[model samples]
Target chain A: MLVYIYDGSFPGLLTAIYESYYRREKPEEILAQDQWQHTLFAQEVVIKTDEKKADKVYQAIKDKISGFAARNAYCVFLAEVPGAEMLIYNYLSRGWKLGAKLDFHLADEAVLQVHTVAKKVRQEAHRMLGLVRFRLLKHELYYAQIEPDHNILQMISPHFARRMADQNWIIHDVKRGLAAVYNQVEWVLTPLERPKTISLDETGLFYESLWQKYFSSIAIKSRKNLRLQRSFLPKRYWKHLVEMDESRSRFAESSVLSPQSPVKTYK
Target chain B: MELLEKLEILANAAKYDVSCSSSGSTRKNKAGGLGNSYASGICHSWSEDGRCISLLKILLTNYCIYNCAYCVNRSSNDIPRAYFTPDEVAKLTVNFYRRNYIEGLFLSSAVITSPNHTMELLTETVRKLRNIHNFNGYIHLKAIPGADLELIKEAGSLVDRMSVNIELPSASGLKLLAPQKKQDLIIRPMDYIKLQIYEHKEERKISRKVSHFVPAGQTTQLIVGATPDTDLNILQLSEKIYKNYELKRVYYSAYVPVSEHPKLPQISQPPLLREHRLYQADWLLRFYGFRAEELLNESQPNFDLELDPKTNWALRNLHLFPVEINRADYETLLRVPGIGVKSAQRIIRARQVRAVTFDNLKKFGVVMKRAQFFITCRGKYGGQISLENKLLRQYLIAKPKPIQHSSPYEQLSLFNESVPSIPSEVMLSNLTGEL
Candidate 1:
């Protein structure tokens, strides 16, 4: 069994893929070196991150599968799953070999699993579209931050930049310390400093108040269901939700004052 | 008032309209437009009801001259109302779009001043978004009932989709709930939009170069449980809209009991599960080749609440099942309980190569537990011993008790403990390899 290791970056992963195909090694035999713990009897090779090697792999993937599939494969790799390295390598090798006919065969567990992961990532990307709330900062750059479950900041940036082609806005993936900034006409990705807690501006808070008031006013009093609302946009996300403070506060106040049932209220 | 305040007020007011989805359309960026419409589905935010928040689901103004009892923004309601200038709305849309907050704008209103006045403001906003702003993203404008025909046609040219809410199904209900709104006013414009879409289609077929109009098509929403209308009436209305108007969708919003109006039903909560069931039924009618007459007739008004519409229909007609998987036609396969459109397609496609067995069906991601009873594998039966196994049917639908094997819960706990060592995005992305 040949075990392959890389620097645990996207380019590094691509390079490893290049090597696996180059050496004609089965993907199952390949193991990420960081994950490899001295397998008693296997040939191991460390794949250096090379742009040329990555490009070669990318070209090969595009040639075999659609560019869409290749990009999806890269996105799957970005997920950073434990067995993802081997799984993707296997999926690519097998998928390419099978050709376009591979889509007809969802029978393969590896193909099905990878497809499911891709779908989940896509679903999260879509959900973030609705859940993401922006805060206007002091710089006039409409700023917002998100701690997404997936690396979706890049996936979501182009849509915003094209639609908002006259204003500057920055969407910082605070958890990843990566940001996508659009300056009216174009957008680019940038890395932020060791991310600390960002202070909410007064206008941000004011918007929060207004938004909260708006949300409360629209919610049907007779149909208010906190449990269900919390299920989708979990309470943990409420702190960032502009319209959520008053509801949570109201709940707290009611619990303190009346305790049981607490009398559900909405405007 | 400043533009921001107006935006907040109007956007907030407009939030109640439910058809803001950016899905079901495939408009790409044209010569001058900014963003493109995604056919694969976009703008997937959900309200508290877990409904999709696709477009900027907001109104131009909550201030109204009409007093619809079901609507919170009715003019008579002593609520803090606001209105947005055409520029303010355009700016908010640009900002929201720039931030990736909304697909475009879902600009609805409460008949501010009059229908014509509200319609004029809306048409102006959409025109600016399309021509002045050169924004081509998806714009779903609410066509105000009783608005001028010329204004409606002009607005339709600038937007991707348009809707005129049939808040109530019948004329009597409309009169009872919303005294100001007339059936003719809403239906007439819908008739006009339908004719326009038809004419546009015919023109495209011949000319092949005329710019597409209402590319996303038209859709309407019916506030269910608000009036004493049954599922049959609602489905019938939806069917008519789909057939006559060529509407893209008929959204059924389970009426949230908000106000204590004399004409309204004194219910505690909206029939959410029922609304969900309607969506399922609607999907079946649209995609699965099922008809309204087949699912619900004059006798059976409401859908079965316990079992889903498909499952209920399948149960009521059981002799149709146990059809041969490899040989049964697409329609026959679709009729089988627990078999969806995707699953049926999978069966058809996979069976072309080899005869699909029980094992093969499972491999194709079929829910075998539910399907096991209804299918025979290569003339072999593994279903209930007796054809009339009522207890078995109950068991099939019964909830399963907790049983831990590989223990995904434990795995998740371990994952949570280790997450602090690495970034959550990378960690989640790596696990599923999705992002």
Candidate 2:
């Protein structure tokens, strides 16, 4: 059995795909260097990433197959699921043969597998778009920490860059030690660690309190369904969400006047 | 009032309005702007009640002039009243948006002085958010029913979506519950917004430079179980509203009994099951191509408590069953009980490459338990027994639970019990006898 191994990068995977065709040998497994396990009887080939070769494969996928197929390959690479490298290789191998009709062949197991994995990656990115909660830092830098299931920092940053064009923000993916940092102009993905001893300014605390109050007050007590809430915003994501912090009891008294309290009528 | 206190009161007041969707508007962020609108709306959080908190839904004020029996903010009620200035609302929206806590603002209001006065305040809040704050986020403004057309039009152009709640399903219900609100007064703004949206679409076709007017289109809410309106009445009214106004959505909020009025029904819990059924039937009307008359007639005024509207329809119309999976058209496949829009489309796409066997149906996301009775794979029936309506319904009726008074609010677990397993072979012999 022939096993192909490459560094765990999108370009590295693409370069490996290009080499497979140039070498004219179908490997039993395509794996990242870290994920490859040695087998006593298997032959191993290490593929170094070449930008030129990677670009050829990417452009061919776009020009020959379709832009959608190219996007699916990129998203599946970002998914980082086990055996994802082999899945994308198999998917693209068929894509080269069938051209644009590859995705339409949903009956094909490899084609269906590629579409499903890509969809899951895209869905996670879209979910993270809403789940991210930014906190105001001292220097007016907005910082949000997320521990998403997938490596979606690059996928969702373009959305925030467009939405928060006037502000500087950093979306830190705590799980992957990656961050998409934006400075009112453009964004760049870089390795970042969880900041130690993070502090919130006075207004930051004030707005956080206000948001927590709004979140709890917005829920109707009679219709409370924690099960349904968990289904949408899972408990796993509750760690970073400001509104979901259990330490800050939503029912804690902040004022003498409750929501049910009668106030002086304004007529 | 402190901002926190005001939000607590106002958000609690606005929780009854169930239209929290921030979708269908593609408002892009301008240069140096603080935010943009997502075409498919994002839910920042899910509240304890399981509803998506997409936008920061709040009322400008809870102070009112006219007393509506169903409204918590009605003048006769003694709830705490508070109002946010236009600037304060805009500032709150920008701050929350900056923190990525909400998609945008869903600004509603009670009639503080008059409908026109309240409309002006709502309009001013959105205008401040758009122009002064340079915030291009999704904004859904509630259109005051009796407000002037010019005021409504101006507000519509500024916001992503606008809505005027129909309040009650029937005209008599409106008269009984909210006497000051006439039927025509409630509908006039809706008509005007509909006309303006249609006109804006035509204008955009001619020139791309034309600005959007209610770009997400208008939606409205009808309070269920507040009056004696039947499921038929509600569905028929929704059909008319969809046809006449061309609304993007019609939200059906189960009447949460807030105020105890002599005219109101003395129900302890909100009729959530009924509301769920209405939403299911409404989905059929909108997406599944089912008509109101087809789902419910004069003989059946209410939806079946055990079966969903689609399953119920399929059971009643048994002649259309055992549809050939490979040959059935998309519309015919959609009529199957368990085949939804996504799975039906999947089946169509899958069949283009290879014939879909019954074993392959599950992979395509088709629920075989209910669909087994209705669909065929290569002229072979999947159901164990013959396709008799009575026998099929016996297998299909959802487990009977306490319908009205359940407190934990469990979603109806449909088809929980396993059906008789499909036999391994010899199904073609009974294929002719089954149907």
Candidate 3:
């Protein structure tokens, strides 16, 4: 059984898909470079990232299937799940046979997995539209910091750019060390390193206090439910929230974090 | 007072209101403006009670002339009273919106001195937000009862959504709990807003830009459990209003006991479960095409605390069950237990290509555990055993221990309460997505 491996990049995975079709042999599994799990009796095939080869596979999917289906395949690849490379390969192979009608085969696991993973990315992107809280930096830039589980920076940035069109803002994906910067008129994505410190200007600091006051005041006193609060905004997100201060998180739970409870709290 | 202090008092005064949705408006961002609105409202944060805080929901002032027993801002209550100037409110909305702290302003107020005086200030705040600040975000304004119709129309013109809250479900409750408020005073504005919305639609056909008059339409609220109104009475009233007013939504706020009144029940907390059940039943009325009389009669007045309203209805009407999956129409499939709007649509879409089985239906979003007893997959039955109606209810309604899987120590705290297993198929009629 052959196991295909590629660099942990979406185009790299697409190149691997092109190789499987070129070889006329289906790989048993496809894993990322760092994601090898030591499969017994598996012949490993390392595929390099070639832009031309990846473009060939990309054009085939886009030309054969509708653009919507092609975009769905790309998003599914971005989900970055362990065996997503092989899942896309299976989906594309089926798509080439049936064109745009391939997505209608929801009963097929390969098709369903593509839908599920793309949905996960889209859902997270929608959630980030609300979860992002911009801070007023001393230099008068509206900045927000997010450490999302998925690489949803591009997905969520367009929304902010449209909404805050006149304001110069930067949305930093702290986990991936990338940023989506909007300079009043247009927006662009660039690589960013984690900043050493983030200082809130006096106006930003004042509004944060007012917002915290508003947040706490709005909660119905008779219904002090930490469980429901944690369920919606989860613990891992609390560190970034101005109102959900460290004290609130500490008072809500024990030292030991439960897995079922929100996935992340503090770094 | 500082802005923070005022926000605390004003938000405290406005806490009883449960209309937190910033939906139904799809206004896009202007060329040099601040924010826009999505059709499905964005929830920035949820409060401790699991209520979505979509908008910067606060009052313009906590000061009031009328002393309503149920209101925290009643004149005699002597709570810390603060009034935000129209400029302050406009700036506050823009600031919070720019920071992504809120969707927009849910601006309500107590009747200060007079309804006209309070409404004029509220309308001015929104007008300033739009004209002066160039804020194009969503603004949901409350139509003050007994205020001038001209002022109400002006406010409706500026804002996306307008509401006149029928705080008490029944007129008698309004007379007893809120002596100053009359039912006609509230209904008049609602009727006027509805007529204007109808007129605007007709006018928009002639001219595409008819100023988008109350473009998101009107909504109102009913404070449940505050009066002796039964679920039947509440649902009937809601049904009547929905048909008559063409209102966007009817918000149900479970009455949280704020002040002591001789007539009011001294319950410690709001009737959340009942509110939840009513919302579920309301969903049935609006979307599922079930009527109030069908769901509840004199024999069954209140909803069962254990079973949801749809499940309850399905169990009673078991003769309609075991529907053939391949042939069942969309409406019939919807009546089956656990078949929601999304799943029903999925089933219809999937069946267009090929015959569906348990595997296909599962992928199609059907909830099999509840739906199994009701549906058949091409003449094949999945149920291993069939019990009598009584035994089946006992099986379905029994609470599976939530803490058993975690550990024994989970039993020590009641805060680790058993969560309702249902994903709450019920949603607000106006809102598109689940809460």
Best by DockQ: 2
Which stretch of 10 consecutive residues in model 3 chain B shows the poorest summed lDDT?
B421-430
TM-score to true structure, per model: 0.80, 0.91, 0.89
Best by lDDT: 2
Computed on C-alpha atoms, the DockQ of candidate 2 is 0.63
Q: Write the per-residue lDDT of candidate 1 for residues B1-435, one digit (tens) a residue.
A: 865466556655665566756665666665535666776456433355444445666777777888889987877888777777788778667655544545777878888777898899999998887777777678888898888889998888778888989888888999998988889888998999988877888999999786667778888988888898888888888888888888898988888766788888888878888888899889988988888888888888899887778877777777776788888899888877767778889888777755777876776667776777787777877665444677755856777777768754444465464544568788889999897
Chain B TM-score, candidates in order:
0.88, 0.91, 0.90
Instruction: For candidate 3, write residues A11-70 as lDDT tens digits.
Output: 788888888888988988888888886778999999999999988888888889767778
Share of native interface contacts recovered by each model: 0.29, 0.83, 0.73
Candidate 3, which CAPRI tier? medium
Model 3 collision count:
2
Docking quality tier of model 2: medium
Number of clashing pairs per prediction, in order: 9, 0, 2
Considering only the true interface residues, what is the Cα RMSD of candidate 3 after superposition? Answer: 1.4
What local lDDT score does residue A7 receive in model 2, on the 0 to 100 scale?
92
Error of 1 at B278 (Å): 2.3
- Per-prediction DockQ comes to 0.17, 0.63, 0.53
Q: Tell the DockQ for candidate 1.
A: 0.17
Q: Candidate 2 regions off by >4 Å? A: A37-39, A246-267, B207-209, B398-435
